[model samples]
Target chain A: MGRWEPNARERLELAALELFRERGYDGTTVAEIAERAGLTKRSFFRHFADKRELLFSGQEQLTRLIAEAIAAAPTSATPLEAITAALTALDSIFDDERRVLARERQAIIAANVELRERELLKGTVLTTAMAAALRERGDPEPVANLAAEFGGLALHLAFTRWIEPKAGEAYAKLAHQAVDELRATAAELG
Target chain B: MGRWEPNARERLELAALELFRERGYDGTTVAEIAERAGLTKRSFFRHFADKRELLFSGQEQLTRLIAEAIAAAPTSATPLEAITAALTALDSIFDDERRVLARERQAIIAANVELRERELLKGTVLTTAMAAALRERGDPEPVANLAAEFGGLALHLAFTRWIEPKAGEAYAKLAHQAVDELRATAAELG
Candidate 1:
């Protein structure tokens, strides 16, 4: 019963973020979000399990994207190399439009401890899944784990910088910079 | 009014773990833990905020230990070097007796999803604290962050192995190995 079926999900997400910003996350309701999106609560539920899911909906897709990229890396790639390649693929997932909303969403999360814990949990799961993918691709136990942790750190490093970046800055460049910093950190620590 | 007065806190910890293992964490009671430890509920509350805290009481001390170590490292140390020094300081905090209890607690946590999440949250807090300490020591923003993440990973790598370590392996040695692996992961990724 929504006017636009094709972009109902995207519209709901935008509407939800606006409401979350206008009214604190706890103060917002699904009905308000749905109404703002010109949709019904049913359509909202069909897209997201609950209000919290709006914040975390992308976690599943992001994890899958990284895992698939890791699994698809060339056979000649080293564990870190494979991971870097996988991370590079994430650069294009966000464009100019998504960046503005990402900053808003981050503010909401930073203001709430429960949301931050969920973010940490999601990060842990992403690291675990990336490690599993590397293991599946024939990496060793702890090495795979360490490499996956690096991958997670690299993505976070890049993603954070990409949040409120300069007008012309690219996400991939930030990722590469994060990768270099991680390398220097490792080398320096050693 | 119970039998044991001295080392009541220590005895309560052991007894709580024992009862948790025997009766499960959810089934065990604060009063029961107190009774098993030969102490009063007053002493139990004095030692721990709640039952879930029984397994997590060390979090505050551990965070303090790592943060103080980072803050106290030589001023000339690079961020990574400072973190290495912080990680090195952790070796003396554990003895064989504590290791046994830590393993028991980790087992209980691994068996439950909620407990696992709590453990992960504690780890996140420890990392944030370490990062904050690094920043205090004059490390630049991202450098401090990367160093803290490395520090967190190093502690995790060492602590995890120490839980089920080989008879002759040392905690500091494992920490060094983890540092080396992190370095190599970064190098390989680069």
Candidate 2:
């Protein structure tokens, strides 16, 4: 609190998102983002390494948050409950503005194959991170890993449904229902 | 039988596998594979669209085999049991020249992100196809789709474990054990 950064990063991100949505990721450049933010390219470089970096820069933070949430989950909670709590924590971070930002981010990533691959890799990283966090909580290793994998798969399924223009209600609510349906399906199969 | 065309596709597939094993996927070319098969480039194209197509050329046949297996399963059999039978059918196809081909195909795809995405998409396609097959056999749609997705996830997890360089004994056996473990884990959590 002693030093306020004046939301420079948020401003940069918003400006970049607007420009990217208007001009497309390839058509827009770091220079454009910087100019829109009333900053120099040097300042932009200090913030992000490149154009793609801006799109993915929040992933590390998100991963850290998920990890922390999982770690802080009650020991008596079942694996699924722990996971749901962690996801709920993530939902809070992704309020309306963040959801819009994420939708745009997904749009840009979806249109580009390389970006999609990077997004997949990012997902893999988050899964691995979540698994590691579960293991740290003394869960059995393979089960812990699989639990995280299921969480990831569930998230993807939920998000895919959420992004559809026809999807109604809140994303978290849809995600919770999807998880319940998935669990019911899995149990019936089992 | 008289107009068999001498199983030209199989010959070309064998030739491609040999060339890939000898020089790796990147080092091998369509022309080289054709030359090794003692066939013209046109004949190679007749058999496969490109070198990459070789990786998935048998997928259609394998899907049909899996569908047949699932269809033939007893109605009294549980969902997991039916899906296990389908996986067994898949194993028969992969186990013939499994050691080299499985590892080689995996390595080739893992090294390339686009190939991995295509592989995932192919897996999703197969899941949809299997789900449709299950529905045809009297299972409800949502349950059928979930069964297919669960089976696919288990298979992917099992294959990842089975393909480890140090993974010992028969892969089919390992896969069966992995499925059992997954069922147990799901039960425990449920």
Candidate 3:
């Protein structure tokens, strides 16, 4: 148990997701997840604070990716353009292999109220981060906040479509389409 | 305890807020709230599922009000126009007296992660309700959802301003200004 294990974090995540799907999220325990992963509970705790953290461990990385992308956008880019760059940056993470895990994770979250709330909080945090990055690039308050919110909405729609069983479009493409649709929708608002 | 209590709900809410403000949310008990309200714990339970409900009991009513307002908008109204009507309808709930309570409530929620998560969930629920009402009025999916999100952002901005100590404008006015500001920001998003 004291010895280091290879791929311990990834193993715990897959095992936890499998257990959560087979048994309800509420019915699974850390000990069971560790057992399924063939790791010590100590190793499991080393990777995640709890079962929920296993599901959201990528949030911090995703937030940083988005913020950095927005920051790296050309200085002349509009708020929405900066947000589009941020969305495009996420394409690597949502590659085909991850789509399967994403679908499972969405189902697990949809079935639990606590997880849904946490997801909303995480969405809010990311949106705020995007806005902060935009502001740092010299966008005003209203533009930064509104663009961040629009970006959040586009990401949500893109993710929803990306997880559909019959969906074939790339994440970046879906995200671009979502943003264009939002732009059209915004233009038509009376 | 078995007899009916006049304004029992309101009394309980006030008592709960006071206790929460004085002792902090986690330190206050339903029994203490009930006692402070000059009522029994049974009366408290009869009005609210728990102490958290005391803070969010208005969510259902607010959701219904916004949805109904959107439904009642003129047939020729655009999605954003209908959303505007819904925001104006909330003016009744944000009168000057309620502003004081809202300020305290916001502080309480800001200080606690659990409460903040619940608040975000409630906000999402209200936004969903607004979008559904817009859909029922024949706005397509994208328009309905985007308009509802805008309406939510406006409501958030309006509420934040309305709770400020120096805020002098009516809630409806603040709400209208927020929507207009969002529209301007959207137009310039490029």
The candidate maximizing DockQ is 3
Tens-digit lDDT string for candidate 3 (B146-181): 888888889999999999989988899999999999
In CAPRI terms, model 1 is classed as acceptable
Q: What TM-score results for chain B when candidate 2 is compared with the true chain B?
A: 0.85
TM-score on alpha carbons, each prediction: 0.86, 0.71, 0.96
Query: Per-residue lDDT for B43-153 in model 1, tens only?
Result: 999888898888898888878888888889888888877787778777777667688888899999998889999998898898888789988988776677767777788
Q: For all candidates listed, what's the TM-score of chain B alone?
A: 0.93, 0.85, 0.97
Cα lDDT tens digits for candidate 2, A11-46: 788999899889998899898998998777877887
**lDDT ranking from best to worst?**
3, 1, 2
| CAPRI quality level assigned to candidate 3 from its DockQ score | medium
Better of 2 and 3 by lDDT: 3
Clashing pairs in 3: none
lDDT value, residue B70 of candidate 2: 90
State which candidate, 1 or 2, has the greater lDDT.
Answer: 1
DockQ value for model 1:
0.39
Clashes of each: 0, 0, 0
In model 2, the runs with Cα more than 4 Å from the true position are A1-61, A74-77, A101-129, A160-175, B1-8, B71-77, B107-125, B128-146, B157-175
